[model samples]
Target chain A: MPGEHSSKQYDTDLETIRSKVLAMGGLVENQFQDAISCFRTGNVAQAEQVIKADENVNNLEVSLDDACSHLIVKRQPAANDLRTVMATIKVITDLERIGDESTKIARAAKSITERGVTTINHYETIRVMSISASNMLHDALDAFARLDGKQAIRLIAQDELVDHEFRSIMRTLITFMMEDPRTISGALDTLWVAKAIERIGDHAKNIAEYVIYIVEGKDIRHTDYAASQLEDRTTN
Target chain B: MPGEHSSKQYDTDLETIRSKVLAMGGLVENQFQDAISCFRTGNVAQAEQVIKADENVNNLEVSLDDACSHLIVKRQPAANDLRTVMATIKVITDLERIGDESTKIARAAKSITERGVTTINHYETIRVMSISASNMLHDALDAFARLDGKQAIRLIAQDELVDHEFRSIMRTLITFMMEDPRTISGALDTLWVAKAIERIGDHAKNIAEYVIYIVEGKDIRHTDYAASQLEDRTTN
Candidate 1:
């Protein structure tokens, strides 16, 4: 720390941007976890806190974007280094959107709480969905940090499972609402929160696609994950 | 077209990029319109076409992204020109997402046709929402072309109206589902299509935010459009 050469400052800057990307990812993960907790317990205060904290996530996105632009302008990095910076730029955006989804979930949690909590069996599917989505997000950031394309592929496959869970949840909720029309309002709120979790999975999958793009220079997006999931069903 | 000087080719490059953005926007708008028509008329053939057309949108995104990267690396543009490139990069992502939403709506249309459609009285709100969201998208693109921040703000306000329509549609569908359990499947299909249209509005709103950013050189994102929409309720 004491005798670093000025010539190595560029490496330091790149390292700083990388660490900040992870920091932003960490903040989003915590926000999502807190939102899930608030939904589980119907804790309005915690939900409000999650909403307020999204400002920090949004702020980080703006600052990191400016930092990346400055680096590009100053360094005029070679192709490889430019790819790294570009990947970082894209990753923060997905992270920020993940944070936005968390806020939406928090608001859904608040709305569900006000509408009154339903029995656990009706919402057990939501817990499963939250776990799947959160894990995909954590793994996505991990893959980005390590630049692991193989693991990103696994995370992308995991999204199909989340999609399966979503369809299952929607079916279950539709039946729930049909059996008891009085449960319609609460069931609708649950649907919103579940939809938010599914969107979090989508954002995580997008992050994984960026990881693959960085590692292999392959663009794997717009590939119809739903069609793949359908194939998964018929073959197995 | 053949007499242009080489010195003005930089402007030409930027203009080419701008026109491509609009072209992509037009393609997405058509996809959305076709998907809506499919839903309105139960036209499965048109829905399939909309789904297949998304590949073109995806290809345009990748090529434009590469073009932007090459421009930045080769030109090392100054701040103002750099902003245009960055904004174009972000705007295309939103347009691609809008295209994806159209595909989703197309699938929903196919599913609805299989489930059998209800009479028109139930879906009139969807038509209104389609117009609102589509207009926002068209105007957002025009704002980008003109660098008009004022029009972007107006488009932002219009997103609130689309959101309002979405909530109304959701409530109506819930009531419809409750009134007759036999209609549950059809109503759910309708719900999905409505949600996709609402998301198209959000994508358009995001494009408007990028417009404001380029015009004002200020970050106007994550500003709680929903909150302002709420304020618009009690005061007026």
Candidate 2:
């Protein structure tokens, strides 16, 4: 309790930076949702808006990263505090990458709009998958903010669903291309959009993994343990 | 000269970490090269080898990240030293992602081999584009290792050529799918491989941008100015 006043200030600083990361996460989620809506509704203006908003999302990443670094240098907090700062840095990086994938989705949406979205009517699959990926991203951010390693592990399980949807979309598109050669161009466009969405899920999973690293001090990427070992470990 | 000796030790610590990062880069480059060769030569064995090597690459990432956090906490490095550590963190993240992309390429290679690799004869464009992207990654690591901002800018310019190659491959595949429905499945397989290669270039470009950020303290990502401002800045 001797350092009580400064400790309170440190907590406030950490909370403020975490809030900034959540803000960036919210922006990226919007970009992804709007990109999907553009592809679904053939709204060229929305697609263009999403593309322009990506710059703002990127700027947020740069600033938030600098904030995390400044926090480390100024506070020089040891152990858990240092891990928290490092995790925040990694989370913002994933958020920025999710924004980049959203831009790709927007670009593909614009192309599909130009070609007419009628024949390329597989937007339903994209819609479902994007909603799932967007939600994963949302929960991943929540997991990071709350430091709930349990919830983070659950999101990792959900990424497999996204991957399954991606393969399903690919199969449907390939069949469409084979049936009508005229749909090849539009199918390819839609495929690109789906691919972007799939990548968003991967980024979200990465954010969740970072959360577990913060909460549990375990790096579970490139492995299945996170999604598997969720039962008795909480008691430990 | 009072802090000269300690400062020299700090420089050595920085160099040692940078050397580890470059070693990781070399390993990822080998994974990418072997992945492409696996696809080109229809060698399932080599493809499996590349896939297995991805785990080692991932392990290296986790260990290197821990090392970086230790450096920051122990050194309490400020200003340029802090930036170097941060940049190294970012560079390794990109390299790990490149390893993931290489795993995708190797998986696609294995799939192509199982499919007899005969009808998916678009290997030439993939080979060309992959070589361009691989060289970009190599130079990006060199830029990071040498702290060469100018060379980093050059690598960014070269990424455009890889993009061009990707677009060319896309066009050719779309035509192939349209002209003969029989090739639709094969075309899709090849497209996935092309996409993984295209993404390798992108991750490489991100590494280059980080190089510029470290050397010039400017974030030039999602911008064209880095590649354009080389000539006049030498005097500055």
Top TM-score: which candidate number? Answer: 2
Worst 10-residue lDDT window for candidate 1 chain A reads: A1-10
| B1-236 per-residue lDDT for model 2 (tens digits) | 12423466667777888898899999999999999888788788899999999888898888888888887777777755677788889988999989989998889888877977586566786888988998999999889888888899988888889999999999988888889989988888889899999999999999999998888878777677775676567657
Cα-lDDT of candidate 1: 0.83
Give lDDT tens digits, candidate 1, residues A120-196: 42456599899999999999999988888777887898898999999999999888877877677677788888889
Q: How do the residues B1-236 of candidate 1 rate in per-residue lDDT, one tens digit apiece?
A: 12332325556787888888899999999999999998888888999999999999999998888788877776666665667678788899999999999999999888777766655334575999999998998999889888887778778888879999999999888888778876777777778889999999999998988887777777678776434544676599
Interface RMSD for candidate 1 relative to the native interface: 1.5
TM-score of model 2 (CA atoms): 0.94
